[model samples]
Target: MPTTIKEKTVLKFEPVHLSDLTKITDLYFSQTGIEKENTNFEQPKLTEEFGFPIYKLVEGNLIIGYSYFTVNSSEEIVFKAIIKPEYSFGDLESRFINQSKQKYLSKKELDRKGMKNSIMRMVDWLNWSR
Candidate 1:
């Protein structure tokens, strides 16, 4: 069975296992209404090599949302969060930020530097309304 998080449960950083990867993939396909494919299977490999972490938002045994991260170095971490299709983006964003902050705070000094750089780069992806 998949690990469960209680309602309003919050987590910072937790190690991810192969089982979690399977659960996450299942959740992703279910929520996105997409079929699973074997193409580009490097994500799981990357996650395993770098000690990526996964977090779940659950109500009882049912996962409501999930997030994961990949840390390439002390200062570089990439995060992805997904929620049920019926949920709002605001909810996912809030949870992601909360979890990220926790992970950042707990990271080693070198890792923190990489994480900051990654975050700064992420800002460039956003469009500013004029």
Candidate 2:
């Protein structure tokens, strides 16, 4: 258990299975009472509607956050993240965007229209990922 929700805890991210939704929801509502009050929140039929991998952020064995993403044929990615209300982990959001950008760049077939800069950008991302 976290000692302080105000401080950001280093979290490890890994791909989550569809069957893990119940566990994720349990962790989320455990931190808040408002969710149980409404009963309006519905589980997104993500995999069936948009095919893509979802990643979960964990502190040891507990899943504290998850990112839902979808990439189109044009390489444009749509992303959304759900985190426990008590915790504020900004790095998770940046990583999700970084993954989206990296995916877009990987599929992008940029011609000589600024090839030098494009290569530089890719190199930078590679170094950052390390």
Candidate 3:
């Protein structure tokens, strides 16, 4: 038997939502193993906030992985995870992150924003670990 082209799967990205919390946490636990104990994989308070863009990869009804991000008081965007080793960001990085659209800053830049935002950085990383 041969599979039809229409049956092939195509992955797409969408914003993470409250409904996806469980699945995302599971993947985080699975991907990070026991390291999940102290992590914020189950907490989405900030990620659930506005401007904190979290995107997940979906193929049909399945979520493959997710890209998690956060914004600090510096107004710089922090990328927490592009989770999954096989997640090839490619050109889709622009779909989710546009340097021209926002004052996107790397983790290094966030370091200079001050210790307060840096602590927020740590917490945000914990939340996005999954």
Candidate achieving the largest TM-score: 1
Model 2, 1-130: lDDT tens per residue? 7686586567776777756656655554454342433456643221211223357777877777666544444544456566775555557577764664465457655343344333345334433432
lDDT score for residue 109 of model 3: 47
Query: Where does candidate 1 have its weakest 10-residue lDDT segment?
Result: 42-51
Per-prediction tally of clashes: 8, 0, 0
Candidate 3 weakest ten by summed lDDT: 44-53
lDDT of each: 0.51, 0.53, 0.54
Candidate 2 RMSD to the real structure: 12.8
**What are the TM-scores, per candidate, against the unseen true structure?**
0.46, 0.44, 0.45
lDDT of 1 by residue, 1-130 (tens): 9999777644333444445655655676666655455577422211122223356655455565676554555545666667666553556657664776576457645464555544344333211210
- The best candidate by lDDT is 3
Give all candidate RMSDs, comma-separated: 11.9, 12.8, 8.2
